[model samples]
Target: MFQKGDYTLEIKFQGDMTKKIVGVYRASYFDKLANETRYVVSTKFQPTDARRAFPCFDEPGFKSTFSLRVVRPRNLTCISNMPIHSEELNTPEPGYTTVFFEKSVPMVTYLAPQYVVVSSTHKYHIPLAKQAPNVEYAASIAPKMVEFYEDYFQVKYPLPKLDIIGIPEFISGAMEH
Candidate 1:
């Protein structure tokens, strides 16, 4: 490499959406009411899986902010570490919509959140649509949890919002992310 005053790095790669339940995989659950199996795509980038999805300095100390954009079917919705900045409902591809998320706070590659494409009826926190009623209890208690943390830590929580998603199947009971 030659000496450089400024440089830009770009990497393009493709990864399969696998059924392994790890690192950008597809998941499915049977919907008895719907009388069919519904599928969703989600990510689990903990421990170093982020690199499997895209090129990155996949280390905790290598912190960086991320701006995410995702294109998905109109019937599906996406979620990530940050709140949505804006959305483009109309695109060249019919029946698809593009969503842009706010730039994330500087974070490690592992903590970096990934978006999931799930049914619009399934809200972020609870993926099992039939159990959507449980969302209210979590919503009611979350503010108290955050308030307790802030008081205990003696510092305000940093992020604009927090998403607590319940993947139908996950390897871990919980992730700090």
Candidate 2:
């Protein structure tokens, strides 16, 4: 924690699932088989929760590009701020796969959110409601919204792809992330 002259740092750690649902927490859904439970892994890193997800410069002013990769069960679907760049089966760990996402635009850590959802139960839909739309719905409208904003501001959106995620339990009406 001394030198600061342009260096690459890497840190590895593990976190347990939290029932309280903060950053990188687990969510459970009841299955058709009565007592069976299915779990989904998700992240909520707005404000200051990004630290819980990983070791980073957590402040908003520290903008940086992010390349995210996730490894999970083959049946689960992974979504992040950027589109999927590549996906490959994890041969050593059967029934698992690794997904790599495109690098994000320079952004504060708080805006990055990642989700691993159950393929069978998770519903992906294009939202039509103005009040609150599902993630897929929000994502569907992002291009048009970006066009409007860019036209109004005379500036282009800096990201390759925009993503909108819907959280089951969110404190804010909608997070920019």
Candidate 3:
């Protein structure tokens, strides 16, 4: 039996990073600059895939805010639902960097992604070096699209930033988060 009161719960668990293109997975692409295959870690949590990454309510109606931190190789970058708040380099471990992201607004589990990527440079959108030129058209056009939508819908975008990434091994044509 229980009374009406406040409660807190904590759970710790780990999940495997898979080679498939769903959930938390690794993908590889040829690097023309380095002449080798490089791998990146990314996520696709739409339509109920978030449970595979971590323990969660895993339902559309179970909305909650999240603050995320990730440790990755010094050569890569991490992106989450919110902008980065701080980054610690080579402290917890050598050759590894820890990134902390800001707390997210209340959102469904599917929108809270833990996306990490590998790139040669921290340029716009972090596309592979070879594909950088191709991003120019999209970069120029995106603001117009956003402006059109904002004008048509008369509602501002809820997030501070919108990151559009290109996944070479993605299974779906597009995903909002």
Clashing pairs in 2: 127-137
Off by over 4 Å in 1: 1-6, 121-134
Model 1: per-residue Cα lDDT over 78-171, one tens digit each: 8887899998886648888899899988888877767778865555434357676677777788889999999999998878888776666668
Count of clashes, each model? 0, 1, 0
Q: Per-prediction TM-score, please? A: 0.86, 0.75, 0.87
lDDT of 2 by residue, 54-115 (tens): 88899989987788888878867777768889988973388888888888878888886455
Give me candidate 1's TM-score against the actual structure. 0.86
The lDDT values for all models are: 0.78, 0.70, 0.78
Select the stronger candidate by lDDT from 1 and 2.
1
How many clashes would you count in candidate 3? 0
Rank list by lDDT: 1, 3, 2
Task: Compose the digit string of candidate 3's lDDT tens values, residues 5-124.
Answer: 987667788977889876788899886656788787888787788888888988999997887878888877777758999999995899888888888888888888457666644654
